[model samples]
Target: MTLIEEVKAIMQRSASDEYLNVMVPLLEDYVKAECNNTFRKNGKTVYPGGVKIFIAKACEHNLTVSGVSSKRLGTVSYSYDLDFPDSLRRLLNPYRRVRFHAF
Candidate 1:
């Protein structure tokens, strides 16, 4: 399965709010550190782009429809926005690119 799929599986398997609360930050940190390492090695940033796509996909996969539209759960929203890139603002339009938000 893809990384996005793996993350979704992890979320689905979480037992409680505490599990989600704990895992999300570790996931964000892993993604950010991975992105930084990739940027350093390749001289360009691609991991964050991958992370953005993963988050968007994850939201779509897991979000619930409250009424006419869908809204992500708090954990999903938090993970989606964590450490998003700002430089590729033009390429990734429409979606809000969050830099980082620590809880």
Candidate 2:
């Protein structure tokens, strides 16, 4: 299986919302690394390695596997919506404030 597939499999097996919470950062890091490699080779300003696509796919899979709706909170924000399971809601609070600005 490919690395992405492996990551998907690992995500599929996790139960705790905390685990999903932790996985997001790791997946983002993976995507960023791939994007950087592509940018380095192609000299492109945009991420040409489909990092966003991968992130979306991984997030979708995570939601489906966990039975939650992972909605985009903003351009660079995401959160588990109201449809998430109660167990998860208690563990994953999406209402926490976060700050980000685009220059």
Candidate 3:
């Protein structure tokens, strides 16, 4: 399945197509930035399986906490710092590129 279709399935029809079209690519770009753009090399691009899932999950998280820095639900409260999530960062560790400089 395509990325949008896969993400839509996981979201369970929560987001609109227009929103997904905009957010999915933005999130994918975020992932590529976090991983140092290794997915693109020498005019060829590739994405590992996990990357796709990560993008979908990130989209969900963004939709869940689109606005407001903090929210309260009954006795429960949540805060959004808007930083890249640590959990998502873990997923990208395997793909992160490291460069070494010559001495």
Q: Candidate 2 lDDT, tens digit per residue, 1-98?
A: 44444445544344454554576567656545533332334564333223434543465555563544464546754454434344432322222234
TM-score of each: 0.27, 0.28, 0.71
Candidate 1 lDDT, 14-93, residue by residue in tens:
33445444554555555455443333345743344555454433333334332223346765542233333454323334
Off by over 4 Å in 1: 1-10, 37-103
lDDT of 3 at 7: 80
Off by over 4 Å in 3: 41-44, 66-79, 101-103
Q: Name the candidate that leads on TM-score.
A: 3
Which 10-residue window of candidate 2 scores lowest in summed lDDT?
88-97
Off by over 4 Å in 2: 1-25, 32-45, 66-103
Scored by lDDT, model 3 comes in at: 0.77
At residue 91, give the lDDT of candidate 1.
30
- Report the number of the highest-lDDT candidate: 3
Which candidate would rank higher by TM-score, 2 or 3?
3
lDDT of 3 by residue, 8-93 (tens): 88674388899999988888788888887658767866678778778777777777755347878899888777765788668888
